[model samples]
Target: MRIHQLSSAIANQIAAGEVIERPASVVKELLENSLDAGADAISIEIGYGGLNQIKISDNGHGIIAEDLPLAVAAHATSKITTLDDLYAINSMGFRGEALASIASVAKVTISSKTAHQEHAMMLQVQNGQHVLSPCARTIGTTIDVVDLFFNAPVRKRFLKNEKLEFQAIELVIKRFALSAPHINLIVKHNGKLVLSLPAAIHEQAKRDRMAKIFGSSFIKDAIYLDVERGAMRLYGWISGPNYQRSQNDRQWVYINQRMIKDKLINHALKQTYDGMLYPGRFPACLLYFTINTAEVDVNVHPTKHEVRFQQPRLVHDFFTSQLSAALQSDGQNNTEQTLQDDSSGVTSSFNSKLYDVAGEAINMAYSFESTNKTSDVGRPYRFLEESDERYESNFYQNKLELAEPLTSQASYVAPLRPLGSAQAKKNLYSDIDECSWVALNNQYSLVFIEQQPYIVDVLVLQQKWLLEQLQQASTPLESRPLLVPVRYSLSLKLKERIEELQHYIEQLGIRSEWSIKEDKLLIRSIPIYVPYLDLRLFLEAVADLQCIQISSLLELMSQMQRFDPKLLAIEERMALNQFLLKVQNQKSQFHGVFKALSADDCRMLLHV
Candidate 1:
């Protein structure tokens, strides 16, 4: 075949194949164009699922009569003028391909009257030809398309059922209605009104619009999240932990007012709900993230449904941190968090060194140990019994009821006593040893200091100890290069996603290179704290995880410490006992978990 350039009509039809896949695509393109034209009031009329006709009327600044011919010309866009403009696109219809593409595949008529014009002008195009005349009566524009895909029989045959296409179009309209809550959108099907949304300029009106699209129940059970980090801001509503979805259909994420399907975003948000949700369930969220346009590339996808961030790692971490904090705090933060920044606060990075909280796991030597059961040691509050699984749940409730609050003021009456719920000078842990304590219900242990009684929650102490360990290290996890870079391949979609996550993966201590030409992955380094990647399956598993941190040795110790005394390995019990001895006299440290036995508490213990 000889090399040749395709005709203008043929080239437009090709672009149509990429941009207009279904009735919904056409609606999306036209509606976005109207919005870009600064339309606040738009009306859409669909017939036969857009196969018979699609008429869109928008009260936006209309095209000048002289530009009618250029308006339908492919590649002639008003949104961008130079390379720099392309990089920082602020308008939605920048490609200038919608009118041309729609014209090539269907019969299109554009009618408009500029505000200064004496009369309206109309342009009609059919089968690669155009005609212009004077008509119409509004200061806005209306675009009418008929017999869509009439010139492309193959594309017509591939369309979905009319009912399904209409549903898809309805969904596109709903997206606009939600994203542009301040716009008035009216829709009609076969000349019957099906939907109407008035402009929502007030907070209450916006909430009402949300109820119509996502259901009132979602709003009732959702928490509002408005947080910011430098120039980036994330604000929206997320359903409470108890309100979940069977599937992730309700997860709506918009970047700078444009809806998108993003893997990194979904993954990070899902991670926030890991333990809060049940298996096979997903959380409902309506979130919007706004960032500088220059920091992201939106032209990578044909439909502009995905974006590439300049610093993906920073963006991902920012999302995870802000969302996690809001979700954890349940929109009412009781724990004040200090956000530490290394530079201008426009960015964030995750402390993957969290794995170092369990350091021995980096060596792949951490494993669960078993032991015999210990006898029930308390009334109404049973310690963890290997055979009695029901007690742990109830015991946690008891701990909350009995544990000392952190804000209790110290009493001058007992200068030697630690900050606790109550001071009992008669009992103190100042001279107690590990062997002198009795394992009590939940994680509490009864100990004797200076021959007096003092009670402490051992589990709480272990957690505090682990935190101190991490603080001492005060460094990021180490990454060790592999002797030979691991190589592999995956589906093209997964390949592209992982490549996009290269910087993020590196922040998790993975150094990798992805080759699009061959669809291969080359991994040169892995986080040192991740213990057992000495095998191929482990390597593959780690790569597929995208990012994972090392486990802290203390996590293992905490679990074992909870085992019934008899079920615990002798060495584990000895370790716990030894730790109890260390805290025997740490009066200032147990402000929240230590309780000196009152005369009444002692009397009850003796059953007197």
Candidate 2:
């Protein structure tokens, strides 16, 4: 056999395999073409999850009768002409391969009537042949792709079930609808109306679209942002810390109006949201980033769902700063709003009754089992994927665990106790011989005891240390003034209840200021260890003091330990190392918490 150039039909089929992945891919390509043609109102009709037929009608600039043949030919495109055009792509698609590639795998009929033409022309193509004829239609375009993947058996077999496939297709349409809110979109599946979004040109109408898609609760919790710097502009709605989801399904972001999954963007957003949210929770966000087209290259990936920024670090920093400032400002505004209605506080009799509570201890052995978030920037639809693949990041790769005490913040004097030299280990733990600690996957720690190795949970150790520290309750907790006073809504009743528990609250190390005229409590001071504590939960602990145990107040301090042990930042790791060392110094006495493992168990752990 000799090497030879592949025929046009074979070449296009191979390209189709890359771009046209499933029914959704076909829908995406056709929609892009429609949008690129300046469509204002688009209609999509699907049958059998696009396996049987797909009809896309758009009122945009249409093809002329003379160019109907070339329109379906491979490499024929009006989007780009030279090498410079590829470098600065502004359209959703540039390569003319979409229509050609689509025709290679499906029966395609394209009908169009340009504004300059009195009559429309329709072209029907199948199996590398085409027929052109006069068509009666408006000044727009209609593409009907039938029998998708008809020429590609292997690709057809790789598709998911009909319902799942339709879901993926619907997701694509929704994305387009969001990016082009000014466009009117109507979709139908199996002759039943599925989605209909009328053109939204006003702010109120756009918000209506958002509420329809993400729910009214999302609108209630989300914050609108609009900021710009030089050639870059960032705008959209991001849910506050209180509104969160267990998964990233609601996170949608676009670059220059193109929806993409960029790791840089994800990392920046996650970094901006750090400390505000627990690692496991994801907030709902719909963001759009505007950058000069020439500054970002969108031709890097085959799917066009990724881009390369000319100045990635600069873009990342911009995203972080803007998000952080907006969120903080929003927090302050909500905290200071006035409430004028007057109401009496809780009854004095109710406040005078002191109750004792007995509850289970907080032993979070499984809290640190998995990293909360990944920087993969995954696809919008994961159910269509063959398997779930994880790509761990190197963003925190070079960072090492901290072995020193934490540095204090501005205008604060809280003692940061550092572990002493190896000689002073006697005070922390009564050990018989040499000992050391090794962290395992941020979940467990392996400590050596009398030359024997055992595993211990990191959270369990932290809790044990905290409980031991609280035994001598007379020692006052180190309190630090907050940079900005945190406000918690103080209802007339809750405020009275909190004032009654003033002694207990002070004992737990939270200081606040109460304004007689204002219905809010300003948290001016907090415990030195944790920078952020949930105000809602703290208030709950005060209100439910009769039911919540004595340890409940200190249990809220668990926010301090919410960090990835293995991927800790340089400074933070140093602080954690200091914390862990104390736990290590006293681990010898945490009897049942440490487990001895056989040689096989150790080997299995290492392999895992």
Candidate 3:
């Protein structure tokens, strides 16, 4: 094949492959451009999951008559002109690919008129081909896109189902709405008003807007956040410590007016609420970050949903510190208010302040009836034989009788103390000499240096184990056979990397090939040592491993060789079974496990 300059239409179609991935992508780009243009009110209409048609009208600064034609032209944009402009790009569509790319895949008609002009101009284009010149129109810009992917049949087939696609589009609109509470956004799906967020300027108004979109209950459980670092500012409402959802859908983040999925920031938030929130639950947050445009790069991805920050560590620290401070402040305020309210009441009691903090409310009517009963008070206390031989024999017989039942129960019972008596506190600190290693619950090897629960990071340990197992399993000396061959769909870059390192993989006696039919890399042979292993998960781990440097890979490989597959499997199974048993025991014995950790334990667990 000879290299030749592609036509404008072909070039735009190629760009469309990246920019116009789906209906939602188109909506995101258009909405972002409207926001960049300072639109205070935006309205969106979609039909047939935005495939049949999509119309977006924004009351922003409309384009001039002459500029209307250039708006849909390739590489033509008002966002950037100079070389330095790329470094400090504040606008969302700096590349100017969205309009042209969208036009290449769909029929687009854009009508606009400046606020100062009496009439607007409309231009129509079909699949990168101009059909009509600028014509007169009403005020504001109304962009109508119809027959999306009409020119690209292959791309159209890749779209999801109608409901799923609509959901994706709705997600984009909600994120944008949250990002710009001052902008009124109305979305109509198939002529039905799916969402409507009126313009809100006050913090309460914004919270109400969010409640209308997410849920009304979110307002009561949300925490207001506002903090600023050197050059970065963070302001938003986050869900309280106990307010959590099952997924990350509610976690909205925006950097400099552009919505993004930043891993560092997400991790920082998780660290802030680590022990405060339940496991497997995510916090609902509407975080907005403002920083120098030059400090971050948004052009790294075609979708512009991901960004690279210059000072990721600083940003992470700032997020954790600010979020933690806000939550702590709320806790202190509530505590102080409770104390003040209690002090205002006149109650005759010994150690009034001490009792106030830990007082338990009693029903006055019930207490008066219970006070008349004195005969049953003595019946509450009972005495048993205290002779050593008799007590020891009873204890032994009870242990023998209860062994099977206790094992089935899997419940932990604390030793009881006499009522109204001074209880001795157990020493939490451990002596170094007495810190003998013991297998804990048949999983972790506990060596209590100072009575703190300690274990290696689970993810790191799992990865290390996997690496060692793969190495040994690849050896031809093993006789195990896999029941199923795992196939992995990888990016072109990752596929190339695998092929480059095929020699190393073959040395482990594992067979692999590129499956052109599925557009993936297929693992035809597995390591004999790990026949039960899930190959898909292993391949994903491999891809993650490839993301790091060669030195890190070598280090990982070395560390992985030390892992024992049998021991790993045993530990995993024991941990899982223990968890199941604990859940069952809790269901039978207790209402729920609301174990409160001591201040020292909290500090240790949170690494505070």
lDDT against the true structure, per candidate, is 0.65, 0.68, 0.61
Tell me the spans in candidate 2 whose CA falls farther than 4 Å from its real position. 338-608
Who wins the lDDT comparison?
2
TM-scores, one per candidate: 0.56, 0.62, 0.59
lDDT of 3 at 126: 76
Per residue, candidate 1 scores C-alpha lDDT tens digits across 228-336 of 8888999999876645554687899989899888888988888877645433457889999999999888998778988898999898998888878877666343112
Task: Name every residue pair that clashes in candidate 1.
Answer: 355-550, 357-552, 358-551, 358-552, 358-553, 359-553, 371-567, 372-566, 372-567, 434-581
| Alpha carbon deviation, residue 67, candidate 2 (Å) | 1.7
Residue range 353-415, candidate 2, lDDT tens digits = 111122212121111111112211110000110011221222112211112223322111112
Evaluate model 3: give its lDDT.
0.61
Error of 2 at 465 (Å): 13
The ten-residue window of minimal lDDT in model 1 covers 368-377
Question: Which portions of model 3 miss their true places by more than 4 Å?
Answer: 116-118, 133-136, 334-608
Clashing pairs in 3: 468-560
